[model samples]
Target: MRRFFLFAGLLALLSGVVNAQDEFVTDSVLLHEVATYAPYKKYQAGAKMESIPASQVEIAQSAGLDQLLSRFAPIYLKSNAGGLSSIRIRGTAADHTSVNFGGININSLTLGQTDFSSVPVYLFDSFDLQYGSSSAVNGSGSIGGAAYLGLNGNWTDGARVKATASEGSFGEQLYGAKVFLGNGKFESVTRLYYFMLKNDFPFTRTSDGKEFDQENAMIENMGLIQELNYRFSSKEWWKTAVWIEHDWHQVQALMSSHPNVPSETLDNKHIRIWSEYENRRHALQYKGGLGFVHDMQVYDNNGEQKIGTDRLIAEIEAKQDVHSSFGYKIGAKYKYIKPDVYAYSSDVIDHEQSAAFYLSSFYTPLKTLKLTVNLRQELVTNFDVPFTPSLGAEYRLLITDLSVLKLTGNLAKSYRIPTFNDRFWPELGNPDLKPEKGMSYELGLQYQYCSAAIQTDVKLNGFYMDVEDWIEWRPGSIGWEPENRSRVISQGVELQSNTDVFLRKMSFNFRLNYSFNPTEIKEDQITSLVGKQLIYVPKHVATVYLIAKHGLWSAFADASFTGERLADHSGSAKFPNGTVLDSYFLMNCGLSRDLKIKEQDFKLSLAVNNLLDNDYQNQPDYAMWGRSFRFTLSTDLNFNKNK
Candidate 1:
């Protein structure tokens, strides 16, 4: 009854606003206005960069980052019963892929991986995925690829407010609010969000094949972000942003037999402050920024284990457009990381520092040919960092008024440093471990066609990567210790296509993506592991989606499929070949309605996830949730009457 009253009040307010307006606004007109004035721009280089569109972002804002990426992108996510999730790209480990926020690396230095489950999709205005080796554009540890998230500072000439509320299965609830205010020269933006979930869904145990209800699984999270921008002059501006977040989760057991005892709990806190200045008045444009991050994690079992990390980052870059067909960029970056662990007997306070310099040049010799070269050098405190270099080329094969064909290729060398836990852990740390090194090569072709009625794009790419001195933990004489003891080879092919057709009063969009990645342990100290596939790395994955929009209504359906994968390494005797997980398919659908009143826009959306209720597991023994449903209500209002 309360919800009904609230909705009724909102409808009354909207009706009043509609009566005050001079003309009725259609959804198509609003969409066109947004597209014409939006500040976000997609990357257009020859590299295989994919940007998430604003429409898709808006639809996925209620979901977490992991769910959005796993369903829409070609990446793979290994989730443990929807509680803890990690990402993999191009058949590489989680640590090999970097996640950056506003040009700062956000991965944990102690764990060497980012937990995708805890990240929110609404925190950033734009998301970009760069495939293959990107250590040249991004920093180190990008052997597989990189993901970039950024907030656009450019604001329109008015003030706007947006709020969203959602409720879903498993006792899920979410609320978010954002405010944008600008007056041409100065702008301010703030966002706040809160989420909670019981996570007590039922699942079947893979070992015994018995259904049981999950317990002791609850999550609560909240975050706040504030950004300020000041345009000192027509050609220069300054921007600053601060973010704070907290998360608490209750841990659950992997199997029914080994139920959680003493009730484990985990808590995480993160704070970041970043600021930058840019000047583009002269022929040479330059930008610089400074950032600081503080992260803390605590786990409570019988006792408490706490870890804290502090990072300081500084970077500067300059770009010069020497001519119409050529340009160059030079940059330098420095990072210092300090970590403290309270659970270790030994003094677990340590610091690591690194500095890197890079230079990139782009040349166009002919109307249809372009080439790029990049070089980077790094110096670390106690480790030997390698000198990385890469070369990329693109050529237009054919060009016409309505169609174009292009070929692209890239080759690069990259490396990853060992984590602090790998080198400084009590009694098991290895101080002499070498950094993992790898080389990657890729080639692709893209074809695009556009006409009055339809537009289509298709791309096909293949990549191969070879790594030496791969790091792994093994049973030593004393205890388990980290070592560089294996060689790996990963090769894959990716195919993607997108089509959009415009009709009289409706539009149809379709997308298809598929990846075939096979990673193998070619050489290992243990003879049994050689010539075996890497554990948890699937060989085949595919996704498809179709969407239709007509007037004020829109609908979409999508599906994803993941192939079989080994549960454990071949050398392990605890699990045999039968422990492999079978392939599974997941389907989802959504329907949404849009409404406009004066300068305000309202949307109501209903989404059904896991529509088939397939019982499956991304990780062995960790079952996933069944079918689930969610409903969301969101509104955007412009408060400035001058518009």
Candidate 2:
């Protein structure tokens, strides 16, 4: 096959380079090196502020991401209870982007967001977010961006164990444990996390829709990530690695009782699995996996009447992705979707599948300029094929040893086919629909200055994107049928800055970001959304953090703020006029101290979220947990740093 030959040629080329340099060729491969390196010191501080993994970008210096992230006005966040929500890149709508776990195509699922609350940072080797029109490597219907989560490899050295506990404001309690075992060839890791949110959360509003009594909610998550690698005794170039992961989650629902009615109780669960295999450069990497989700909702209709609703989903996926040092990277993947909803006794199931292939060029002719052109074609089980293309370029200008001028741009065509729930679910199914398609563009500039005494960086970026067939759901005249007759147009801008100062034993970092969006609807029936600020899309969001480090001691302070915005499609009138959730700022403060236990070095940290006990609402009808505190202690033991 063409792929086999391409990979084989690249392997041969790489082997010769490794033999000469005694290195893995990572330095010669920018992208691969970015994935393997720990990142520059300047970037490390910015990652903590943005909560985005460092592997997502390559820069020798740092900039203010907090300020830039705030400009896009993301709806949900890692700090929010609903779940981890990322900013819409290039002003694209949420539906335009594709979401992925490992290599699984999660873009076709019911929910657009993934919960990152339970994934222990230590277990992840790296996380990367590709902005604007993901390539075929991720499958189709991805117009906005793609986020990849990678687990650590080469865990076959020895055995390791760690445990931690923390308690914080709002009756918050946290506990976690992890175990790692390896025999120089096989590896396994198990992690468990438990978080409890009690009634101690404060509420500033009153019973008349004002600040009422504080509410409470709780959640539990358990996950296991295992990887096994086999190295050929004779063929060191040929190796196979297998990965498996499972995650389970449960949560307590929030109560909405600003008036007199008691808060309703809710519970839900989810199970997911991911697996993949890689062959170094010997051939191509093969990956495939599946996911199953069960969601149940129960509530009292009118105090005496009880109602229940359930949703079950099954998703299967398979793909073959290849990376080469020759001229390009290529991949193909397929996904099958089946979802059914049950209310009382009636039920409906919807089925669909998606197949796609992508190609990315890797050869760059210029020393400072790198360009990549990608194309993908996808076919839905019952729809026409859509061809998407993306182009990206990065230029690094060496201004001086301590500073560099970096410029980057991305252009892509995107599309999102209707989901099963969007087209076939009872009371919400719309079969007569067209897949939404779009185009996006972005350009950014960065400057960095890193030295022994001080480190500082500043970045500026401007981007815009538009979409058509922006699918919006329309309720069918019948109690349980649905139609799609809505579309939308969105545009926005972003600006950000970051800086830091390094001292004898302390470091200070600062960041700022801002965004602006004006959107509208095209249909008359959905006119209610016209000229109204997009729901959950804040105009401005910002975060600031300060960190200090001393002999065996580290301390930090962080604060985040979101501007007031519309709550739903109705905007004002019918949706409760002027129901604007007041804007409030939340702060977190923590301190970590190093300790020596036997031959191991342990670090203990105590932190409090919402240190000021500020009352806030993540949603108009739902309030967020009040001040919470946690204590975490961890230590690492390693027998080898370089192999």
Candidate 3:
């Protein structure tokens, strides 16, 4: 608390310090910085692309939320339960992809769900979606890929303000705002957002031959973010940021197939705080931070009508990095995390703390060629730690100023440690369990041109995970225990295409993503999940988007397809092998225009979601909301736009 107040005072004092100095002010930075020459755009369309300093990006996506989500059949996919669930990257399991905001890592407690609505889409300056294998510098939790979100800093002169409001079908409303303040010596950025939806979905089937009223759910989110950067010296900088988010959700929805599952209600809240500092040496950069999070949840279960759970966790990390003369950049990092969980009935105190150290190096011997290598190790008191290694390379051929060719590949070892709830919950303690480890490989290629560009990237990754003393729970067995799972192998391939056509002021963009996986269980008698396709994992999935932009008018249309998936791990008849839901495609369209009022910039947009009025569900057997429309208006005020 003392440190917090001290930092606050410094920020207050530094606000005036910047005014005393004179400097050329840049525009307010976005939260994340997209990359130019992005690998994924090789074969997709309707992608918002940008370029940042290459060294600044370890692994990330270079697209914005609006551009990425607009390409989907549905305008948006909601993950309201925990973390950010329902995340599918090239048809891989949600767990396969790793997501990070700023520098904080988030893990979900619930399965098959995530909280996407809470992410401040507009505040992010750039996003990097690294597909294939895992990044070693960020640790060993990823097998599919990693998505890194970047927040912007205050650099604009005077103040910059932006506000947006939108209304759509089903009582949907949205509001968002951003403010940037800066002087020569001090800078600050703040953001606010609110979204609400009262969806009235129409389902195709009902047990009583009557369509259900649709899942009625409402989400209220409040976020406060303040970042202050102070120049301790010309080469040294001190920074502190506070972020708080509160969500209130109420749901009275019907479960698919299990209509008798009863209407359910839940209330969940999350609070997080983080602070960091960075300094630059003659040739090295040093950075570190501390973060804390608290989660409180209450829900009604089938047997236990009233149940609640609370969790608190703290994490810390520090790193020192350097970029060398021959385009070689290297870094080392250390991290520690500890979490505590409490339930309504009894307080089960479980702690999972890890100390990790990693060394990573990237070298570009030639201007068009790059190579990267990484090695990492984790130390855990109660579990055996493993070493992870990764390698990647990128080659670019400059055909002409207007065209380019690129090639990329990667190989890595990754692992996932069971969460506290996964290993120590009252009804699910599995002491003999071992962490699952994976090895992955990927290769891709790209081609580009001036007027039109098309790129195709394919990744084939094979992974064999061994869970010695694997843990599982049976309904009538001797509670929860551990058993050796012998062997598990999961393999898949993901292919993507993105292309853009530009002629004078008109442009067209298209994108396609496809993925398939075949997972095999080699252990007999481990009936729980043996011979079963991983639950919630679709064997085939794809999305196509078409968009055009001309002058002040821009429009987009998209369609997404998801194939069959097993509802449970049991290979039994509960949900059969091809008991798949019919594949459905949805289309949506939107238009936007900008206007100048006095000295302010204003913009308006209207979108008609589910243009085809397709009745579809994202999850198997689940009831999805139907056709809807939305309209949005926004304004931007830059006091120094002319400067």
Candidate 4:
């Protein structure tokens, strides 16, 4: 109720922001808008990037980032029962991957990572992924990769309202609504979502065939977002957005500890506000954002813990137009982190601040070749962070109206800062720990074929990285403490293929993805740990999916496979150095039909996840859900500008 009242108040306040505005995105030959705060324009000349189309975005609006990425691409997620999920790209640590909203790094300052489960897809208009060490572009915490989520300005002259409701197995429910109004100059978008789940599905222990019900796993979450865009004129515009969400969840005890299960619950709340201004004529842009998060945890022993974090960020950049065959961009950014944790040593609030200046240049000496150089230097109030630099080149061997082939390569430096827990924990924290720094290199080949009826695109890439001064908790004089323990060398191969076929009355789309990642500890204090794969990082992953659409009916089937993974860092005393987990396969399929009733549009879909009822464990002792069904219905109503 409080959230609703706040939403109403903010809505009423933004009601007066109607006026004229201009477009936000511009077109370029090779690299488009790669602004830190802008939408995903991943058609970068020498970068390995991926984008989920608007169709998929619309279908998964109520889902989480984990769901959207996992369903559409071949990515790996470390998931546990009771609504906990995190992502890894190219075998990087969970914290090494960064997720950004409106150009702000949303990773937790205390834990150094974002909980993908808490991020909803309903808040953004775009989903983009950049793989393999984008720290030079996205600052620290992007050693592995970066994800950008943004909302775009709307200039269409129409007002539309969309609503969706869903019910699924194991007591799941979801309701969401989106209201959008736009004129030639002003646009307003409002979204509201509520979801609840009682994850009580029964699962059988693979080893003993013992049956168990997933108990004490319940989740309730709700949120609202309002976006307002106004073009001051053809060359200047301003936009702002506000979001608020609250969630409550229970973490079910693993089956192994059933008899001794403890009652544990967590409550979380998040609030974010973002605003930006841009002038295409001057080639200048400004962005600012503020976000707050609070979490409370309660255990069975009557002990409770609370944590709060606030993030404030600002950025300004200018781009110089082409002079000769070269163009460049320069920007500066600042970020502040305020953390309040009951677990900290002091009762006073602690804060961290960092600022960075970055420069990037684009040069095209020939019609078929493009080159880019990026450099960044960050200054921290505490530790001395190193400078990051990147070089990229793309060469087109063949370019024509019908087909094209290009080669891309990049070399970059990446870094990661010590998290709050790593530096300020009650007693075990280490403030003198060195920052994690790394270097990465990648090469790729891309081919595209297009025709009136058929289109195909294929890309293959390989990457290698070495990270030094890896931070981890180790046994010290008394207990475990954070330290720069070892070095890691990660290497991987990735392949992606997409094909679309348009028929007289039907269209078909197919996509295939495969990745082989092997991350090994190169230099560790413990001899036995050397050459061992990181825990929970898979060596192989593959996915394939197809979408077929007719006049009013559509269907999709997607499947993914994970290879065997290591479950422990230390090998058992007897044989192999570590405990290995079995690989598993999963499949999901859905069908939907569109209907036109009077003036409104309606859609109904049925999806079956884990279609094979396969048994799998993302973590030791934690079992995943089996086959389940979900039914969703959505309605869309549109009114003309005259209305």
Candidate 4 achieves a global lDDT of 0.76
In model 4, pairs of residues that clash are 20-185, 20-231, 21-185, 21-231, 571-577
RMSD of each: 8.5, 10.4, 11.3, 8.9
TM-score of each candidate? Answer: 0.91, 0.76, 0.78, 0.90
Model 2 agreement with the true structure over 103-132: per-residue lDDT tens digits? 454432554433344334444445444544
lDDT of every predicted structure (CA atoms): 0.77, 0.48, 0.51, 0.76
After TM-score superposition, the amount by which residue 459's alpha carbon in candidate 2 deviates from its true location, in angstroms, is: 2.5
lDDT of 3 by residue, 157-227 (tens): 57788888878766666777888777656777777766665555456664456665455455455566677
Two-way TM-score contest, 1 vs 3, winner: 1
User: Alpha carbon lDDT of residue 587, candidate 2?
Assistant: 68
Question: Model 1, which residues run further than 4 Å from truth?
Answer: 1-46, 258-262, 301-304, 343-349, 570-578, 640-643
